[model samples]
Target: MTFRDVVALWLVKEKRATDVVLAACDLLVAGEGGEAVARLAALTRLEADIEVPILLPEVMRELDLPHHSRGTVEGREEGLRAMAVRVLSGELTPRELTKWTHRMFGHEDEGWRLSELDDAYDTQAVDSDEALDAEVMAEVRRITS
Candidate 1:
């Protein structure tokens, strides 16, 4: 999908700000070498009102990505690396991440339910920390570590 389409999907369909941020981060990371960095810079500018200090780091941790302090080049790079790791590890698939972002950041729909996505993707079964097996736990640790 085009960058604009990805942004539209995240904002219009996901409705969760956190999801949108995460998906955007993933896209930035997956793009061409320096392109990801440039995309991230642009996204940060576009969402400046969203407050990177309060959002990006937490989302990074949630996605099993790395965290960095705000407003620094190193922090930006680290955050992107974290996003890349999450994408590679199956912790967050691109499509699933996009869908979640659409719901999280998009307009509010009182009828929206996380379960709806659950049923549609059948992919979030791994999100539960309590339900993970030893192997899964190890993978989680590897991702976090």
Candidate 2:
């Protein structure tokens, strides 16, 4: 399938702000503008209450887009890496990673895919706790290392 088709599918299926943000990030990274920007704008209009702010500061400045923190459900590894960087840099908490990872677990191969993290991805417990956070952090360490 085409990249746009994949993104369109993600928008239709997930319709989450994170998905939009991640798609926008991918567009920015690929140097796609004009039609891409229009597509994202159209997406924001179609999806109610989606956070339109871009996540990466550099991308925001370069693209002149709004700023916010947020992903696709194929970019799983990239999403994990981004979250891991945030966790290691004190920008994101372990609890947050745990939550995001669990959410992403549902979209494997549809929105995103993972090999290294596939087995360990959804291993996080349902309950939130320090120990759970630690488990997530260990997973983060694995991603980063």
TM-score, per-candidate, Cα-based: 0.22, 0.38
Q: Give the TM-score comparing model 2 with the true structure, all chains together.
A: 0.38
Query: lDDT of candidate 1 vs native?
Result: 0.40
Clashing pairs in 2: 18-71, 73-111, 73-112, 74-111, 74-112
State in Å the error of residue 21, model 2. 14
Encode model 2's per-residue lDDT on 59-121: one tens digit a residue: 345456433333443345544555666678897786666556556665455212232233344
For candidate 1, what is the TM-score?
Answer: 0.22
Global lDDT of each model? 0.40, 0.50
lDDT of 2: 0.50
Off by over 4 Å in 1: 1-48, 76-145
**Candidate closest to the true structure, highest lDDT:** 2
Cα lDDT tens digits for candidate 1, 44-140: 4557436533544444444454444443444433333343245456766544433442444232332123224333344546444233233333433
- Model 1 RMSD in Å is 14.5
